[model samples]
Target: MSIRPADSTSNPPPGSTSEATSEATSEATSEATSEATSEATSEATSEVSSEVSSEVSSEVSSEVSSEVSSEVSSEVSSEVSSNPTPNLDIREWIRIGTLEEIDKNGPMVVKGIVVFQHEGSLYAVENRCPHMGFPLHLGSVCDGVLTCHWHHARFDVCSGGTLDPWADDVPAHAIAVQNGIVYANPRPKQPKNLDWHLHRLREGLEQNLSLIIAKSVVALVNAGVAPARIAEVGIDFGTSERSAGWGPGLTILAANLNVIAKLDTYGQILALVQGLVHVARDSAGRPKRHMLQPLPATEFGTPRLQEWYRRSVEVRDIDGAERVLLTVLGGDASDADVADMMIVAVTDHFYLDGGHTLDFHNKAFEALAAIRPELRPQVLSSLIPGLGNPTRSEELQNWQTPVDLVSPLFAAFRELENQLGRISPATLASGTSDSPTDRNASSIDGSASSIEGSASIMPSQTSPLLTDRQTRTDAEKIVDVLLGDDPGVIVETLTALLTSGVDPVHLSGLVALAAAKRIVHFHTQNDFGDWIAVLHTFTNAHAVHERLKQSQNPLATRAIYHVAMRIYRDRFLNIPSAALPKSDAADRAGYSTDLRQLLALTDKQQQVAEAATWVAHYIDTGQPMGPLWNTLGHLLLREDAEFHSFQMLEAAIKEHEDWEKSTRSIAKDAMRTLVLAATRYLAAHAPTARELPQVARIAWRLARGEKLFAE
Candidate 1:
């Protein structure tokens, strides 16, 4: 039988690890019954054969990826690790002549298995190297270990377990001899090892082993484990292992979780793997947290606890803040109280860490919500350190020099108390946050000062969708002023609205809409790195909007001030703002959309405008929103997107609903615009190395009993 390599063309060869998502075969197979054309494991091989991935051609089952990077260790290991009784029937077995004939030939390939004489016994294993799909038949067996010459990956001849973590285990087939006839079983019984898989997932996370994580996720998913449970393990490990608190990796994981239900199984697997691997990367090499405990004997009331928490964060006292947070949990601090306290701590600062502090706080809660409420303290405290030394925009030159945003913001915040009569937990979600400080240095002007004075940035908001200046409600005008160039007017509009008993939550959401407009209008012509600045502002604005819903904390309104100021600052990015995709671009809108056109656009880089336009056209026509989002979900999974891309997508989805629920004049078509924003951001970052999604596909196939090694 001709055996195909991993991820082969309509034929074999597969992917790369160190490999979050680089295996890029464009084919899918319903039944991969082909052989490796040239690519072998090592010189003897390649990764998964194109046959496997091209074989994937028949089943996008995942459309999950052309980035198939998983080692097909799942099936191979299932064979070696399981102990199912061999079938008694001989009809299904392949007879390889006699044992005497095997000894005379030294080793022989029969039906993709290499029958070999090792020591005094006969062992049969897959002929392809589980590492790269090279023929193991070409390898050398010594001291009972079969070593592939290509990568020097060694495996036990009898059990087929790999000696190297980088390489997956080679499958060991069951063999028996009757009347000197040696026969091998082609089908290996896959036992449902749910607990074992969970344990391995932890091992994968602990060791930061990508392939292990890949295999284990595929196995657990095959066992029908809830994705939330898998995410919980990663969250538990990620939060506890890293001392700095919830970082980008964990945030990305949570962000993806917000929309995991929107993805297909393939997309879901890819989304989960991307999130988990990021968590692993973040926790890797970082010292595990020392873990602060709640105060042992405190009779602290909610007021005192809130004050103590805020003071600790204020003094940059991480330890004190953690203890206070823990104390609240130890006592009867309701979830809302706990959330408000954290929100107050972060919001009091001017866009702390350029909004990361707020975003992280929100996402941590979202991560908690995704799993269980019981893991609250453990997840909540993970956000404390982030509040410690965040970059307070008030102290930054950008907020001071050309634009003195701080003094005015604090002044506007004076009426925050009068607006909120009741207290609530800071509502939340997650996002990326940074000023031009995070932009790459090579841009013509990727500097803090560059974003400071762009008068043109505010004018793009003149439209009703962006800012209904002529609209009736204070909420509507607040939206208009936020999109204006005058910082003083923006502050005055927000303050007067609050003083007039306007819901701070409703007002905060308007700022978020203005922030979203900044993104929807974000011009791709600016320094490529400048996208982060606008994204940070929007996500930060969105985080503030979410928290205000669950919280009546007046201090939380500062985030609103901070993001409004950030929106003012990011105006320059929209100097030549991207044009809104015309509603008339398509004949009529529908509930159905063809993903091929959209997917093809992502094949090349810098398709930001094209992608957003295409999505807008299809969506503007009558295409259903569900399938568009679903396809976008798959498209995102197929690429090696950065943390910010995930942030943009999730935040847009969450914010779109907020807009859709509104009966106000400003809310019209806001949902469509948010989708356009999401489309633009994703298009801006598409076509990365793409190694992670491939790994997801490989694991998925392995779990389904496809021998990628031989396919």
Candidate 2:
């Protein structure tokens, strides 16, 4: 029997399993079948020899004498002569050959199995070998065994059993031959194992690809504009100390994309968390830095991003322990924000109540050790205070914050230090205090002397950088840290400065002004409050400069008032409502009495006036109330003298509003502005003040244009 190889044009070689072979063949079977049929038809119509026919002439003549016999023989002969034809639909079973007629080593692609008479019997079995799915037709048949052409997987000819230990049995086909014709039943079920393997393979591929894509999205965000802009800002401010100097921070982020993308896996995730912590540690620990790259993508500078930033800076609601822990356990948090973000990403594992949560905390602690060893103890202290309830404790401890993790935080802090250092007394002078003796002894143009003289004449021009005569006389206390002598004061001042978004340039200049005046050493204690207040003062100076330049009306007015309110809050030690409240009426009354006395100071009185001025500006001109109302509101409700002044203000605005409608509206606006400033001031410093029935009544009357309280 002539057999042809499974059409290479249609099917690839069988893979490790029959299923793979079938799938490949199915893809190309249509074209191969067409080619085979065409070849067979052409062969049938082509040349044939007459010599063999003559040898059987008598038999042929006899058969032809019977018309049916003649027709059947002719048809059979024609089919047999076809080049590549394997007749598939003949009803007559005619004995042709034995099973050994076709090779067993190779896969039986075509005409591979046969039926033949042996000892007056006929049997049939598939000619293809089972192992490796190879063609049995390509190998030699021996005795009752069939071996594949490729890997020699042997099988029995009769029972289709495998002789080789590793070989599988070939299937048997129902075969019979009659009237010089052969027939076969070729249907068989494929092996079950092959199907299962294919299914698993497909599933694995899909899962892996999905994971890859998810990771890529995260990496892309990290490598985009946010990081780039931060890097550029860092370089500009001389804070970027990353290797290779200046370019774009995104480039570094992009370089890590591969690592970031693989973070879905536990090992990869751990590596990423560790890597980020390491980078943050390096950034924070280093005292000096090299230039870094510019930001990528212009769109990152969207107004929405700026808006988000502005809003975030104003939010001071984070609880004390969390804040303290973040600082103590997380090492200042200025440079390691991104590292914190990385840790947050792995929190899902912990949140699910899986064992992975412990692992997550372990890794987190490890990171803390590597990057911010100093903060570990503090953070632990803060966390321990509230860890009694497991759920709440875990929620608190889990790193899941979604802050921008921008480089600006670290850069800003660095700039703060740099600005402070640049204008530090060590750089510009020898003494700490801006004393008259020190000023006279210095050759630096006596700018300090001039500033002091101006300050004496107009407390507003206490700032050495005043340009306007009106402002010089009316200039609010730009910074009053030097007015006292406390390091704690400096800390508070610095903290306030941070809140106001004080920029480096203005800070440097302000420091210079202070240094020129030799004012720093004038104080006795360098405490938290003093630093924080000084910071507020510096920030107010910057705010004033910005608002005046923009002059965007209501918005600028609002900004300026906020600065003024900060100044006011620091000027008087107005207790914040957030502080521990008094236990009873007696304690509350006692505290109130003492606070009243504190407000009676002359300096505090001046601060109240300054706050009033800002509120007056806003209400009369329909300008931004800013921080004025809020700042003065607390003072008014907290201080007896200041509270009395509100009644006077009410009368003045009422009398002023007795004019025409427009004039009355203007007057009302001015009064409202003043009230608003006071309200805002109270809100910040003494929220409970507004809760007072009397204070609320006054606020309600002012808001509603009623004059129940003198106005």
- Alpha-carbon lDDT of model 2: 0.29
How big is the positional error of residue 650 in model 2, measured in Å on the Cα after superposition?
Answer: 70
lDDT of candidate 2 over 1-711, digit per residue (tens): 332222212212211123322332222234543332233333221211121244433433443233112132232222223332233221111123323442332222323443322222233444434333344555555665656667777765545666764444565544432112222333221221322222322222223221222222222222232222222222222112333211112112211222222222222222222222223323333343321122233343322332322222123211332333333223332324322222222211112121122222222232232223443443222222222222311122211112111111112223333544432332121233442212322332322232222221113222332333342221123334532333233333433353344542333233322321221221213343343343334323332332233222212222222232233323333222112111242232332222223233222322323233333333444444323322232343333221213322221222222222333223343334324322223222322322222332332232222333232
Error of 2 at 420 (Å): 27
What is candidate 1's lDDT per residue for 618-696, written digit by digit as tens?
8766677777777888778888788888888889888887777888666766777788888888888888888888877
Give the CA lDDT, 0 to 100, for residue 664 in model 2. 27
The segments of candidate 2 whose C-alpha lies over 4 angstroms from its true place after superposition are: 1-134, 138-145, 154-172, 177-182, 189-711
Best by lDDT: 1
Say which candidate scores most in TM-score.
Answer: 1
lDDT of 2 at 56: 36
Question: Cα RMSD to native, each candidate?
Answer: 13.5, 32.1
| Least accurate 10 contiguous residues by lDDT in model 1 | 11-20
